[model samples]
Target: MSDRIVESCRMCESSDLESVLDLGSTPPSDNFLTLEQLNKSETYYPLRLVCCKSCGLSQLSYVVDRETLFNPDYPYESGTSKFFRDHFEEMAASVTGKLNLAADDLAIDVGSNVGILTAAFQRNGVRSLGVEPVGRLAEKANMAGAETVHAFFDPDIGQKVRDSHGAASVITATNVFAHIDDLNAFVETIKILLKPTGVFVSESPYLLDLVQNLEYDTIYHEHLSYYSVAPMRSFFDRHGMEIIDVHPVDMHGGSLRTYVAFKGAHEVSESVGRYLANEKEQRLQDPEALKKFGAKAAAHKAELFEFLYELKREGKRIVGIGAPAKGNTFLNYCNIGPEILECLTEKAEAKVGLFAPGTHIPVLGDDFLENEQPDFGLLLSWNLKNEIMNNLSAFSAAGGKFIIPIPNIEII
Candidate 1:
């Protein structure tokens, strides 16, 4: 890949962007390859991190276009994980009661994968609509009774939504705010699509948690920015919005449920100030923090590969569990592939027979694990450890050991 250079910050547009960490090159996560495509060529892009000196938003310097990165085959669905499904339902009730959304008013969800939250909103008597980029997921969401538009959200789409359904009373985006490249255009559209007194609620993986846990594998082409409360205050203020509330949610490692509204439309919560102060004390936005992250990542990579090598030397049969996107980053960055593990198993039928993009490791189904019963399992989706452990109790009963790759490599 040729060098795709970005001189300025994505959020603040300041030329004083500083390089912090680099994860080398990686293929688009979620780009699981078909059998025929595997024998063909695959592209990789630079995975790097840089910080905005002006606004403190950390982001990837080399950006892959949204259309190519979010290609039609993106296979994530919110309903896959029981945690997200239940969490969304709770969020729907909380926000509905907090904002007092009526049956006649609209709730608009952006990047609404499989419309899990949108459906939740509808179930609670609030009418809901979704804007999704992937066609297949959108189609499935519509089939499942969630009104969704198969297109990316932009200012033009916002206006069309307004013309068709009127301004939305509540705007929600979950896990998609960090993936947007053009921050300016997106917030402008949100401003246009929101009712004067409406609230915009969003959730994103917290930067402090990523650093604390050394969760560097979350860095990928799709995630353009890493956010903290310190930066968001200024970013929203510049776009004619105010940060009203910040609630730390423990899922996805750790994430922030941020509430925003037009400037002065809502009272600024004391929680926002507390988070800003906490970020400073924790050094969440400092350039030196990622240097520590880079060091921890390097150590983890070496330790994990050493463990795998020892297992291979002992002739232990190994396979992977849950073909999560984070697994691709860890596997590819550590140079582990088909030779290191026989195959990776996942529950998703769509990914079962396919292969991970860059590493080209085969993804298998439940029956494969039941029959093969490998000597060891690599818990790639370590974040889902508790639920996965319960699901794979049979493997453990059969004397199969599982290795969890995270803040530390551990065998259980």
Candidate 2:
């Protein structure tokens, strides 16, 4: 953790911040340790949340250093799933068609992992570029058809892109907008890099879903802010941008695929008003709502640990499904380790030989399931529940049950 804490809201600069949920100190979610690194000490940081009463943005209290979090060894790849690949292609086609993009119209993706989305843009004959912070991933991305600039996205980098590649017509950021601690600079960069008529679209996990589903595990060091339409509208308006529309998507459990542009670039849609009304109905901006949210998270945590410990006492074997970043939060917060979860399995080669940080649970190849089948699978990667459930049907048929711990825990 940095020596500093965010005293104000990341979006609205509000001094009226309220403590919402504290998951305690946790290791960096993506910092899976190798066998060699396991012998060394690991870093841990306070993982706490505060809701900005002024802007209604729920954000992390402590800011983790960005370089430390997004190093060259970052293991995530956007093409890890066929589902995500298909999703990307569909999204690229949809966005391009919606924007009426031409061959010369440029598309830029911020935080493009392996250049997947940008690659989708290229396949559609749209000029695309990716701004990725991870140098190793950025290098690998060149072969994926999109040119990548390996640097943190900011006004400086945005200026560089505008100087070299020209202003972009469509600027898209997926799941990464929430990870930015300095969102003021982020929005400014968007303004700098985009054309006057350009569209700036962002997809972030919705705060409403996180609160309602008790998706506390998603609260990690990397995710600096959880946004709803209310706060987003206020934040964007202040930055001279307007959220023209909002669409609820089912990925990441639930997310907002929000479309924004320069104040008058696009017509404000009824969808924005509809979501604002829905947010009001849910009391998303109320302090009492977060207090109730904390209560629900505590209850869900208690239930999962109780069930797992009971199974442990019965000598039933348990293992984790995916050693994802969210899994690290779930494991560390619940204090589940090798004693309870024998190991975690992953489809990604980058993580196969690694171990989950804090908890020290070994990560192995997905085929390891065949070598040693555990009696129960605790799906740490529960957001991809449908994909996982579809892949592990044989295990399900063999009476090897799986546990879904979020949005209420269920054993099947």
Candidate 3:
């Protein structure tokens, strides 16, 4: 099937699911089009959010085919951003130090795009391997000196890796755990690959942050689940694993870094309890709270669209500063096409000449800002506003302003 509506909760198999936010239908956010492919038709899937009453897991109501979503031409690369490179480096150091991993120990990164984290693990004195689905990305990682297996991670692949490199001391899935459609199978694969006392690390955008900050733009087909502490704790427990620690990091708006291990293998930190308590206090699982968040998101979208429309009517030229996957969600939801945004400027060479998935706006290189000097730039990658704006100081110095769209639309 190209796509299908989900009938039950992905984690708990619960049928008591309630719809919260419906962003209507949208093309796959990361399907950047080549100049020749733009003439062809595009497939749009239902973009809606639902919450499971049984397990309190928030997820997309529809599941796009993995083959279509993770096509060979997938353009995302983690090493393109220095912030992410440093983040991965720090992650490697922390995980190695905390787990006391030695040079003989193996560290495996699942869905390791271009092996940024895998290389970082090597730098921190651990034998590292990456499991990536994209062939080109796997080849790139191998060429860059990080060994990688090009296949979608599964129990068979897990066992093969274990046989070849021995069981891993630690397995990491950064910003990748949410893309999984079968959590149970994924955890089982983790079970096969990890040693008895091994830890599993996962980092994803927190559901609480998405709701509180009105980051509706992060909701897309690739991200099947919007994770919170309660559901995650219960899900891991069901698989005989327990969350030992939770750390809130300032990345991707707000993300939670969770460390999980086999039951009784590690001492649970108080941070887990604190996060669970906070989720309870904030009514993170309540359908009413999520509904309220939906209402606020709708209002915010209207306000932002009007603001951009007014700026356009005033004869101001505007272009998007970044063409992130989340930016496609925002652009399509707002219906801001080339009419409003002349083009989007990007630093990633893979996307520089491509077009935004749904909006069809041309993506130019970073030099577009300096060469064309649009009157305003919409900061599509608002989460990295500081880094992006700092890098484009010349644009601001030339009297070009930036419009930050999320949390609240502000022009600076």
lDDT of 2 at 103: 97
Q: What are the runs in model 1 whose C-alpha is more than 4 Å off?
A: 1-4
Q: lDDT per residue, candidate 1, 1-412, as tens digits?
A: 1234667887667888878888899998889999999889888998988888778889988988888877788877778878788999999999999999999889999999899999999999999999999999999999999999998889999999999999999999999999888888899889889999999999999998889988988888888888899888888888888899999886778889999999989898999999999988987778887678878888888889988989999999999898988789889998898888899989878788999989999999966777999999999888888888888899889898889888788889
**Alpha carbon deviation, residue 127, candidate 3 (Å):** 0.6
Against the hidden reference, what TM-scores do the models get?
0.97, 0.98, 0.99
Model 1, residue 340: displacement in angstroms?
Answer: 1.5
**Most accurate candidate by TM-score:** 3
Which ten residues in a row are the worst by lDDT in model 2? 1-10
RMSD of 1: 1.6
- lDDT scores for all predictions? 0.88, 0.89, 0.94
- The TM-score measured for candidate 2 stands at 0.98
Residue-level lDDT tens digits of model 2 in 1-412: 2445899888878799999888989988999888999899998899998888887888999998988899778898888987788878888998999899999999999999899999999998899999999988898898766799999999999999999999999999999999998889899899999999999989999999898888888898888989899999998899888999899877677899999999998899999999999999999988778988988887777888888999999999999999889888888988888999999988889999888999999998888776777799999889888898889888787778889998878988
Top candidate by lDDT: 3
User: Model 1 residue 283 lDDT?
Assistant: 77
C-alpha RMSD between model 2 and the true structure: 1.3
Ranked by lDDT, top first: 3, 2, 1
